[model samples]
Target: MHQLRTRPARRLVQLYAGLVLYGLSMALLVRSGLGVMPWDVLHQGLARQLGWSLGTVTIVVGALVLLAWVPLRERPGLGTVSNVVVIGLALDAALAVLPEPSALPIRVALVPLAIGLNAVATAAYIGVHLGPGPRDGLMTGLVRRSGRSVRLVRTSIEVAVVALGWLLGGTLGVATVLYALAIGPLVHALLPRLSVEVPAARAVQPVS
Candidate 1:
């Protein structure tokens, strides 16, 4: 709340920017013809199976994930709703403009770039502390209710998703493995540096 109440402009900008950049990062990985983020593996697989655009699949999946929150009693905030909408739109926009490269060197190089962008994007939105994205909330809620360790719960969920996505024909390459290895440390390093701290409210003095 203090965050919601004060310095509204910067937080909103950071939230939307981060969401858009997140989508762009997803697009870059997809275009690289290498691999994508974990949730995106599921989205891309669904799109291929369904003959839909990747962005459309992302939006639908995000909406569905948000719905899962209802059963978990997780609350959504402005950033959460915006995350569902804006990332999909941004993905579509970026993909429409970006040309998929054929060169192996360029494609391989995109992996690290995309990973770094993803980390910065993640730190920006999460640092705002407005709300967790739907997927993240689901993981936390499951952990809370199931009494599972965060590591176990998150790993189980991601492993299930990746296995399903791979079965459904999503790309799983060295890039996916690299992303898995690097993302944790990258965000860990970037979050504190990027987090937007809302200052405490000033106390009012009694009337003289």
Candidate 2:
């Protein structure tokens, strides 16, 4: 998109803000104790196993995911690399400040709120079109290589991750299932509205 290239400041702002909010949303979900998204399940499990901070596990996992990109021929962009670092740092920061609520009802309420916020954050960063995060790029790459439906590839990948993470001692709860069901529709609804449109001339350019 021309706007993406030309309005670097706005795009950067959107990218960073989206990433920060994404991390915060993850923290919210963690504090809720309702479980987390698929990749996060793995992160949490690794954190527990290694006795490391969740954010540390997140960054490590992100880097490892990026390593998988090599065989897939997935190129990392500024946003992609930033995603590996910023989200982890932000999550740590958020977790540091946010207290875990004692009330069950309050914890329950955080689930939907975290899910909604995560969707918005996802759309915001993706709309910038700088690049897909490592996990997302892995999904797209697999779909390309295997010639499978996005739904099939994504579901298969997630199912495997959740299973492995659960086995590794991650929290698997109703929220995990709920988030899987809800995020697709929410991102679909939000992406068009959130996406930054390119000028007509730039629309025809080859996407990098």
Candidate 3:
């Protein structure tokens, strides 16, 4: 952790930039009128049903999900708490500024671009190694407790969320499926290259 603090400027920039870009990417997808990632599907549904903005729903859901960490014995780091607050704020801000596109071709184009930006943003923040976001931590926690493979746990959770979100009237389409399939590979490829390793002596500190 000390090593993390030692290069505060770089880590902080990476963390905040990644988070801001993540929010912007989400806004892009929403504005494109295409499907979003599973958790965003839930957020969009809840926002629609509750007459709230997507970002408001995201923050609320994130906080609620964080509560599950107690039972899982997961501890939040600076990035974790920042993820809860910053992403939502940035999402709302980006959504406010970005206009929705009407053309089908433009909307379709936006999906892949948004997904790619999302993957890059995800890698940036995660590579900092401060902590996983609340929803991700939940999946990882479940994996640890159940001794299941990450693929199984992640797939199960995503399936449940997508089903529930669809039931609640969230948009589900090819974009959602694309995001699910592409994100894993994108993150996998990016993480190794982007990750900032901690010092060997300070490696004993918990990542989260």
Enumerate clash totals for all models, in the order shown.
0, 0, 0
Report the lDDT tens digits of candidate 3 across residue range 1-208.
5646556788789989999999999998888887988898888888889999999999999999999999999877778888998999999999999988888999999999999999999998988777789988888889889999988998899899888888888888888989999988998888877777766563222222
User: Which portions of model 2 show Cα errors greater than 4 Å?
Assistant: 1-4, 199-208
Cα deviation of 167 in candidate 3 (Å)?
A: 1.2
Per-residue lDDT of model 2, residues 1-208, tens digit only: 3435656787789889999999999999999998998888888888999999899889999999999999998777777888999999999999999999999999999999999999999988887777788888888888888999888999899988888889999988889988999998999898888777656543221121
How many clashes would you count in candidate 2? 0
**In model 1, which residue pairs have backbone atoms overlapping below 3 Å?**
none
- CA error at residue 179 for candidate 3, angstroms: 0.3
The candidate maximizing TM-score is: 3
TM-score per prediction, in order, is: 0.92, 0.92, 0.94
Candidate 1 Cα outliers beyond 4 Å, as residue runs: 1-3, 199-208
Cα lDDT of model 1 by residue, 44-111, tens digit: 89999999999999899989999998888877777788889999999999999999999999998888
